[model samples]
Target: MTKQELKEYYWIRRNITKSEQRLIELETAATKITAQLKNKHDAIMGQGNTSDKVGNTVADMELVRDEMTEQIKRSYAVLAKLEKAIEELPAREGYLIRSRYIELLSWEQIAVDMNYSWKQIHRIHAEALHQLQ
Candidate 1:
């Protein structure tokens, strides 16, 4: 994996998290809309008019939620591959890679966690990237 490929791992993980949140929001909105549709049906029954608008809105939300679900699955697949590559590295390199990319930890935090100086952390990060490649 090149630097860009490693960076992609981070972005993919972030996208998955965002997509999941959006999915939850979509589901909540759909539930609210369904509830409104039910109330409208009860109040407007036999009026010769139905809530086609609300129905369509719920359908659109479902479509978007399904698309987001598929995208999240694909992102997880890619992330798993990237993680496997990182796991193949030596223990220190793997830890450094996971800390920086997967966990989104700052370099200083990683240095503190590993009990290394800032400069030393950078050096290890460089070596870890090389190993990934």
Candidate 2:
């Protein structure tokens, strides 16, 4: 790979990892929000003072939702960087490497999509990675 291509690949890899982490964080926050909402719903379902206590739960849920939204926005930023890097990749290797490695497609899947045998795909992928060094 040319120095520019290598730099692109490095940034793409970093962006992909960052996006994945952001997604994970979003998932975690969403889970917590869901649980909190569910508990709040259950509390409201119960008779008496339980319904009054829901204000705090609702506040917490909103905070979690806001956090998840921010994470999703940051994730989109990372995705934009990754997309630009992918566009800069060499014609011979960029698309395949970005789709397979950055997007996390399986070798067999990439082969089928690319109209190559799995073995050939593996070889080409190996060569692509080697060129980045």
Candidate 3:
């Protein structure tokens, strides 16, 4: 592959990780918002000390949650595309890509898992990228 194409491949591989983190962030925020809405709903209605604004807040949080869900879906699409590229590599190369990037393993860890020396594993990694290129 050309240098630019190789760089794009690497970028896509890394981008999946970034997208996953973003999905997690969206999910966590939605969870927090859901909890806050529930708490406010209970406190307002249960105490018979209700505020109209609390209802508004609940509606707002629901809207936020919906938007977050859409963003999470888009992030998954990005992940799927990256995984497709990785899958195109030879089996061993694919495994290396998945382990190193998707699973976020260290080079030493990958070497251990593959039952190969660290230097050999690094060599294989380079070869894998070359094949894609």
lDDT string, candidate 1, 1-133, tens digits = 8778787887887888899999999999999989877777866565544667677789999999999999999999888889899989999888988898878899999999999999999999899888777
Instruction: Give a tens-digit lDDT track for model 2, residues 76-133.
Output: 6665765565566576567678767556677778888888998888788677666555
Q: Please say which candidate is ahead in lDDT: 1 or 2.
A: 1
Worst 10 residues of 2 by lDDT: 1-10
Better of 1 and 2 by TM-score: 1
Query: Alpha-carbon error at 126 in model 2, in Å?
Result: 6.0
Model 1, position 68, has a per-residue lDDT of: 94
Compare candidates 2 and 3 on lDDT and give the better one.
Answer: 3
Clashing residue pairs in all predictions, respectively, total 0, 0, 1
Screening candidate 1 with a backbone cut-off below 3 angstroms (N, C-alpha, C), the clashing residue pairs are none
Candidate 3 regions off by >4 Å?
1-51
Q: Which candidate should be chosen as best, given TM-score against the real structure?
A: 1
Model 3, residue 128: distance off in Å is: 2.2
User: For every candidate structure, what is the RMSD over all alpha carbons to the true structure, in angstroms?
Assistant: 2.6, 8.3, 6.4
Which candidate number would show the highest lDDT if scored against the true structure? 1
* All candidates in order of TM-score, best leading: 1, 3, 2
| All candidates: TM-score | 0.77, 0.46, 0.58
